[model samples]
Target: MTVASKDVGMMTMIENGNEVKRTCCSSNSGCGSSEILVEYAGNEKWIQGVINTPKGVVPVVSTQLNFSDILGSWKARWGVNRMNYKINPGLYAVGTPDNESPVLVTANYKSTFDSLRKELADINTWILVLDTKGINVWCAAGKGTFGTKELLTRISCTKLHEIVTQRTLILPQLGAPGLSAHEASRQTGFQVVYGPVRAKDIKEFIRRDMTATPEMRTVKFTTYDRLVLTPIELVEAIKVSIIAFGILFLLNLIVTIPFGLDDFYAYVGALIIGCVITPVLLPWIPGRAFAWKGWLLGFIWAVVVNLINGWPQLPSYSLVRAIGYLLVLSSISSFYAMNFTGASTYTSSSGVIKEMKIAVPIIIITVSLGMLLILLNSFMGI
Candidate 1:
C-alpha cells in the first residue's frame, strides 16, 4: 500500500488554513508516521506527526452530521413545503462509513443529496460531497463546478485515498460529461465508477459491483416525473404571467370597452394554457419538439375560446377580433412552453437551439399581427 514518493505531488493548502509544506507517504500506503511543516503568513512551524497510513486522518472540519440531522434543521428553517429557494448547496455525506467504507460522491445541494441518501437507508457508505453552488447534478456538471479539477481537489483536501481501503470512487452518471475518467485515474490513484442516473437505483448498482444496465443508465422523463416539475414552473412564472396579463387586459379595455372582459379573460386563459396546462401535458401533446407541442396545445386553447365565445355568431368584425386574440394568445402560450423544454431531461442542447430558431419568429409574427389587427379594429370602430 506504499505510494511511491515520485507519485506524490506537492502538498498545498488551498483554503485559509495553515499550509502544510512537506511530502509524506501517500495516505493510502499505510505509513504510520510522517513529518508535516505548517507555514502560515510567512511564519513557519514544524510538527513531527505519527499519522496512521492507509487510514487517513479525518479532519474535524471534514466530517459532516448525518443527512437526517441536516434535514431536520432545514424543516425548522423553511417549513415542510419544498421549493428551489429553500435548498442549501454544500457537501454532504450519505450513509455511515468507517475508515474502510467505499466513498460515494455527490453534489451538496440538499434536495439532490437527500434524494441520494434517502434511497439508501440500509446501506453503509462514505459520501464525498462536492460544492455545486446550489445546482443539480446535470446542470452543475455542464457549468464545470462538478468537473474533474474540483473532484481531484476535493479528494486531495479530504485525504480520501488514506480514508478508505479501496482505491475506487463512485460518481453519478449524469456527471460523466464534466469528468474525464482516464485523467482522474491518472491524477489520483482512485478509479472512478459511474453509478446509475437516479440515486434510487444506487443500491442495485452497488450490489451489482458498480455496473449499470442500459435501463439504469438511460434517463427517462416519465409522466409522473414531468408532472412533479409543473409546480415549480408554474410557481416561478406566476409573477411574470400576472404582470403580462395585467398589461394585456388593460390594452383590451382601451381597445374595445364593450368586449374588454372577453379579451382580458381570453389573454389570461392563454397565459395559464401556455405556462400551466402545456407543461403538465407535455408528453401527450403532438410533436417531438416542445415548441410544436406547445403550439398544438395553444391551438386547442384557441378552439376552446372560439367555441365558448360563439365566434361564428358574432359580426364579421368581432369574429376577426376574436381570431386576432386567439392568435396572440396561442403564440405567447407556445413560446413560454418552448422555454420549459430546458427543464426536461430528454431535450438536448442542439434540439432546443434548433427549435428556438424556428419558433421565435413564428411567435413574433402571430402575436404582432394579432395585436395590429386589434388596434386596427379599435381605430376603425369595426
Candidate 2:
C-alpha cells in the first residue's frame, strides 16, 4: 500500500509482507470503481475488491479484460483511441499470497499489465507494476524507461521489503535489456530472475523451478506476429500515399504531363502492392533485401497494367509515359517495402543501414529521371 493508501483510515496489520485492510465508508478517501466495487476498504483506494488470506489481502480483479479494454488496446495499436493507454503503477496482489509467493515485475502499460495478471488467474502471487508511462516493456526497455533506476525507485517507494520475506523478483525477459541483475540485486537486495518471453509460459517456468526451456528463450517473429504489426504501418503509409496520389492527379490535369489519370491510378495500385501485398507475401518475395523485393513486384504490376491497356499499340509518347510511371511506382514501392524492416524481425540495424546505403541513391535517381523524361515529353507537345 502507498502512503496515501494508509492515510485513508487504515492502520497496518503488519505481517511478513502482506496487506491489512479496514473499511473507509466513513471517510471520503476509499477504494472505488466505476463499475461494481466489491469492497470499500478506505486504505486500498486502488483495489476494487480483495480476498483475505492468512498472510494478507489479495486484490480481486476480473480475470478477463472487458470489451472496452480490448477495444482500447486494439485502437492503441494503431496509434489511436489514446495511444498511451495505461494504468497506475504500484504493487498489486494477484491472489492471497504468503511471503513465499512469487513476485513478478512488469511495465505499467495497461495491455502488458493486463496480459501478465490474466495469465495468473489461478496462481497466487505478488505483482510489482513499474511505471513506464504507458509504454510496453519491450519498447520501454529499449528507451530506458524500464531501466534499473526505475526498478530500484519503485522498490523503495513501495517499501517492498516490509511486505515480502523473499529476495527473488521475477522479471520479464524482454526487460533484461534495460536492467542489470547484478545492479538490481545489489541495490534492492533482491535477486532478479528473468522469466519467459511470453506471459502464457510463466506457469511452465514456475513448474520447472524458474528454469526456462530453449524454446522459451528464443524469440520468433512468425507470420501472424508480423501480420498483426502491419495495420499501423499500412494505415500511416496510406494517409501519405493518398495525399501524394491526389497531388499527382491534380498536377496532370493542370500541366498535361506525359502521365495522366491512368498512371495516377496505377501508382495507387502500386501503393497497395507495396504497403499491403509486400508485407503479407514477405517470405515468398524474391531478393534478400526488402527494396529489391518491392521493386520486382512493382515492375511486374506495371507490366500487367500496361498489357491490359494495349502495350505495343499506343499514341506517341505513350510508351515514355508508361516507362515514367513504372520508374515512379517502382521507387515508391521499394521505399514503402523497406519501411517494414524496422517493424519486423528479418533485418538487423547494420543490415538495414547497408541496404539503405545502396537503395536510397538509386531511388532518388530513378524518380528524378522519370520526372525529367515526363516533363520533356510534355514540353515537346507530344
Candidate 3:
C-alpha cells in the first residue's frame, strides 16, 4: 500500500514479522517515508490484532488493562527496572479506528500508555506513541524528549497524515512545556489540541467537544497521589541503608566498639522519617522547605532516641553520642527530603536550586561534625 499526505509519504509491505517499524530516509535525501510491519506475539497481551487502514494495517490495542499490566505497573512503582518499562513507540489503534477518528498522543512509558488506553476502552481512536525514554509525559516534556522536534519527526515517520483524514492531534496537557503547537502545525499540517491534565478526564473532555473543564485542567497532588510516590522512595532508601549499615559497621570496628542495636534503630528511624513520614505529612509539616520539615522530624526522633538510651544520665561520651546522632540523623533526613523536590509539584527548578544552595552546605557541615564527634569520642574516650 502506498500512503501519502501533506509532506509525508510511506509504503507498507505486510509479511511474517514480529513488530512494526517506521524508518526515516537519510536527511541528505531531503524527504522520508514510514515503513510499517505488523504481526508480533511479543505484543499479544496489549495488541489484540490489526485494523486495515488506507495507508496500511495498524496494530490494534485493547483498552482494558490485563493482569500483567497491573503487575508491571506495581513493579515500576517499587523501582524494579522502572526505566526499562517502556513499549516500542509507534502508531497504535484503540478499537476499530477510522481515518476520521480522534488521534491522541502519549509517551512510550508503558504505565502512561496503559493509563491512556484503559480510559479509551469505548472510544475509537488513534494513539500516537512518542519515544520518551520510559519517562512520563510531564518529565519527558521537561527533558525535551517529548518536544516539537520528536513530535514532527514521529508524525513524518509514521506517515500519520495518510493514516488519518483529520488534521488534528490531541496531546496531554502536561506535555505542553516542551512542544510548540504552532511550529508543529506549520511543519506537519496538523493542529495540536491539548487535552485534560489527567487521563481519567479524557473521555469527558472529548465528549464535551474537546473542551476541558476547569477541574480537568487543575493538577492536584492529593494525599493518595503523594502516597503512591512513597513506595519507590522507601525502596531506594532501604537499598541505601544496607550500604550505610556496612559503612557504620566498619566505622564501629575502627573505634573498637560493637555497632549497637540502638544506633541501628536510630538510623532506620531517620530513613523512615525522610522517606515516609515527611512525604505523608508534607502539607501538615510546618515548613515550606522539605529539607527543613524532614530535619524537624529527625531532630525530634533523635531526642527521643537519646532519652530512651539514657544518654543524659550517662558519661560525657554518651552526651557526645546524643549530639552526634542529632546532627547526623537530621542531616541524612534533610538530604533525602531535598531529593524529593524532583517528585513534588510544590517546587520549581529555580526554587529547588536556590534551596539546595542554602541547604547542601549546612547538611555537609553538620554531618561532618557529627561523624567527627562520634569518632573522637570512641577513639579518645572523650
Q: In lDDT terms, which candidate is top?
A: 3
lDDT of 2 by residue, 196-287 (tens): 99998998999999999988977777777777777777778878877876776666675755456666677777777777778878898877
Better of 1 and 3 by TM-score: 3
- lDDT of every predicted structure (CA atoms): 0.64, 0.72, 0.80
**By TM-score: ranked, best first:** 3, 2, 1
Which window of 10 residues has the lowest lDDT sum in candidate 3?
Answer: 1-10
lDDT of 3: 0.80
Whole-model alpha-carbon lDDT for candidate 2: 0.72
Give candidate 3's TM-score. 0.89
Q: Evaluate model 1: give its TM-score.
A: 0.75
Clashing pairs in 2: 17-163
Q: What is the TM-score of each candidate against the true structure?
A: 0.75, 0.80, 0.89
Number of backbone collisions per candidate: 5, 1, 0
Write down the worst ten-residue block by lDDT for model 1: 37-46
Output the better candidate (1/3) by lDDT: 3
Rank order by lDDT, top first?
3, 2, 1
- Kindly indicate the candidate among 2 and 3 with the higher lDDT: 3
